[model samples]
Target chain A: MSRQQRHDARVPIALAVLGWLAVAFFVLPIMALVLRVPWSSLSDVITDDATTEALTLSVFTSVITTVLAIVLGVPLAWLLARSNIPGRQFIRALCTLSMVLPPVVAGVALLASLGRRGVVGEILDDWFGVRLPFTMPAVVIAQLFVAMPFLVLTVESGFARSAGTVEEAARTLGASPWYVFTRVTLPATQPAIVAGAVLTWARALGEFGATITFAGNFPGTTRTLPIATYLALESDIDDALLISMVMVVISVVILVALRGRWVGAIGGMR
Target chain B: MGWRNWGYEVSLSIDVKRRIGATQLNVQFTVAIGETVAIVGPNGAGKTSLLRVVAGLISADEGRISWDGMVWDDASSGEFSPPEQRPLAYVFQDYALIEHLTVGDNVAFGLRARGVRRRRARERAQEVLDVVGGSDLVERMPSSLSGGEAQTVAIARALATEPTVMLFDEPFAALDASARAHARRLFSSMRSLSMARLIVTHDAVEALTLADRIVVVESGSVVQIGTPSEVLATPRSHFVAEILGLNPLSGQLRGDELSLGAMSLTVGAHGVDDGEVIAIVRPRSVSLHRERPEGSPRNVWRTTVEAVDRSDGRVRVQLGAPLPIAVEVTPAGFDALATELDGDVWASVKASEIVVQPA
Candidate 1:
């Protein structure tokens, strides 16, 4: 064989080894959790009330938060991606700030702006008879704030990639602006939207610091799975390990089912 | 002001301004109802911009466009209709088929967007597909279509909208030779569908054969407007001549003879001075002979063949040294002359066939 052909064959082999090494590094913690869990005490931990309540609240609030993100963030995404509005760069940077901010920092920012003695919270208590801190709504709001940037960033990138020619063709063919958006623009960005939703839902499910800081741990209302697992780890290690396994198992199942779709959407964008 | 007698016509003179760059398309022309006018120019010649202005896709910063006695855009009065309100259909260069939708759904998109019933939209899509000779391609996805099939579906989609004005921007630019011929034939055979048809192309053959009138644009302005025969017969500018494949020679004229790059040719009655002048001669007009034929033609020179390249069914032979002239001849003509490689030849042209214009 020629020298160039031998070099090409060796390069791919080296890359494959590096890729497998990275996968093994990521899987180490999950493998440890599986190895350390006690099989005999699994049934007892499953019957515990705190475990079930945290799982239920986590599912309920994460789904609600994702819906809120879709309702509020899609328009912003469209604007950032497609329009020539003034100060667009600054607005885009501001929107992406939440994605990189620590969850605890996000929780603190939310508290300063929406706590009882804070900006809008004081007026809400006085005029609307409402208290927001340490409540279920607070949990939902914190999750929404931290997770919405994921959806907006994904969808905005999608819009940027779609060629403007198709939209112009739609307009010249007697489609109104709204009609064009609903028909051509929306369908083109659908895969991005779905992928963003999946990522945001997963992030919200695993959220911890923001939920605890903004909405304190309560038995049935505010304590989601991550908070419950932390509290159980402090008092009962067996129960905490079992609850951790449940989180790992559920997330693994979801990721496995969605692997093909995720890869397809990401590859299509490229 | 008369409505019944006059048909749909577009008269536009456009000037647009933007921050990055600007286009001042000060073009004034008319397209009679049911007549096909082709806009031909190089890239960045503002052909698509002019079409966009007519289609109401973008408002001109200055000037006006009137259609059938109705004002579509008037800068002085700030009157402009949105694109959706215009009676136009535009076929983009990419075809722009919706990827997620099936071919039938993509074609039916405009009808559905206009509030037609779903079943009626499907029936209309089928009917339009039949017109474009693509009836069997309805159920397939757009991702599965070949370039030609997708373009046919795009044209069918445009036709389904029942528009008065049809605009196509470089629709054949992406197609291969065979596909381009098919598109050209399909476009030429379409009749009585739209009130006005405007196609923007850079291909000379497309402009010559498809248009009743050809408008040549260069540097965002119209340089010439005439029938294809007239333009090809007497090109107004160098760009136009180059696009139409006419050989342009620049030199000086004294009395009846013209002096060019190391060669001399005779002219007609008119005489030009030592000032710069452009001499245009069609490739088909120059005849190559192995021997200098005894003739009354004013221009005959002894030359040698340097190189030859075949294009389509014709061979373009380049003459050597003193006059580097390129002449086109059919394969049969070349064979009949017993043309040899790098051999001595005689080039003859009539004085009346050469056009000399001031540079």
Candidate 2:
């Protein structure tokens, strides 16, 4: 055989074995959950009042969270990527801290800041007679807290990676700054934005620690799919397995649907 | 559109100084309506930067840019208009077409940005694309376009804006040879428009053929600015001469006889009064010989070949001392003479081949 052909065919046994082991480590749990699903009672478990409430709540809250993230996170991403704001690095780190922070810690931080006697929460309570804890808004806030950083970081990298020459050309062609941002910059970074939104939605759908800690698990109000799965683990393991399988299916479908954009975003970041 | 009177007024005037990286760019020039000026220089000579300053993409550190009696930028006053505030269009080197939009939408973008109706903007885009010979490219995506097609679409996009001033930064640099020729003809037709135009290019042929006046820049400074023929016949700096590929020798002119240091050559008829002059010689006109021969040529000199460079089917023999000049010869001609590097060779040029101009 040619030397190059032999070299191309050769695989390091240690690296190949370790890589396969890593793949098996991730795949085996999902395979076990799929196997453990009670096939005859799957429909019955899914249609149960607790499962329906949790699924409906999770879908609605995650959708709102994704939309809110796009609305608020996109502009912040643009500022971080393109503006000369003072202490921009510090601001970016603060915004994305939740991405790496332990979820339970994020829940504690949110509670401290937004609880009844908390800093902003006391003012909100006195001024408007409103309480945020143990509410639907609180669930959304909890999801947004942990989920938005994925979107902000992804779209920020997109904004930074896209060349400014096209925007400059648009300006010279008489496009106003707002028009350029809307028609040119946003559209040019759409792939990353879409990938980021999907990631944010998925993260919100799967939220557990933050929602249970800050929002306090409440049926049909704050308890989302992940919380339902955890609660079912205490009473009925079969129901927990079914809910887990549903989440896995939904996540797999979404990721597969947007595989191209997700892969492109990762490549662009690199 | 029939503003045909040349040199009527200076429609655009710029006197700007700025520091760009390690290069301090100081340039001043004026362009009248219906005038097309080509800026020519080597890489990093600030040609593109000069265009950017005028386009309002980059503000100069000092001085003023005024067009049609209106100030666009004044550093002392701290008054600078952003690019969108200027009635200008810039065709970038890479076309910079919006990849997400169809070619029609890309061309229509400027009009839409200016608050034109969508239907009207699309119609205008179609008309402009037809004018630039890109009607068939309207539905195609920018990503699907070839380099030439994208360049044409970019031109159409710029033209659709109907701008008062146009800036082109190496517009043809990305095109193939045939496409470059086509684009040159297209740009030549555009010169008749009544708006001021500035084109940045390193192509000598483009500068000479397309510009009413050529501005030669070197190390971020304006070295020379004149008509193409004037600049070509009397290059003021070695950079300009090298760019135009001509050998310029300073000499004293007495009647038709020009003295080149210790040597003298009879030059062609120049009607100017006798004084210090510069003579331009084309390298292709200088012939190399193995031995001095009896000839009708008026100028002959013995020089040693300093270097032999062969590229693109032609050989350039760099002759050393007495007159340090380069002679371009065909490979067949060079092979016939049997000249080697560092070998002594006699060079001769006809008297009429020399162009004499005022120093």
- Candidate 1 C-alpha lDDT tens digits along B222-314: 889998778888888776776556666878877667889688898653333456777767778889887878865568888888888887789
After superposition, the stretches of candidate 2 with alpha carbons farther than 4 Å from their true spots are A1-3, B1-10, B243-359
DockQ of 1: 0.60
lDDT of 2 by residue, A1-270 (tens): 899999999889998999999999999999998888997899998899989999999999999999999999999999998999999999999999998899889888888899998799888999999899889999999999999998998898899888578999999989888999999999988989999999999999999888898999899999899999999999999999999999999999997888677666856553
In order, the B-chain TM-scores come to 0.68, 0.71
TM-score of chain A of each: 0.89, 0.96
Fold similarity of candidate 2's chain A to the true chain A, as a TM-score: 0.96
For this target, which candidate reaches the highest DockQ against the unseen true structure? 2
lDDT, candidate 2, B1-359, per-residue tens: 23434544748998999888988999999988789999998889999889899988899999999888789999999989999889889999999999899999999999999999999999999999998888899999999999989999999999998988999999878887456656866786797787899999986556765788999998899999999779988988876765466676889999879998868888764443588876778789899888886855578888899998898799988899888888899999999888777888888987766766566
Highest-scoring model, TM-score: 2
Full-model lDDT for every candidate: 0.81, 0.88
lDDT (0-100) at residue A178 of candidate 2?
Answer: 90
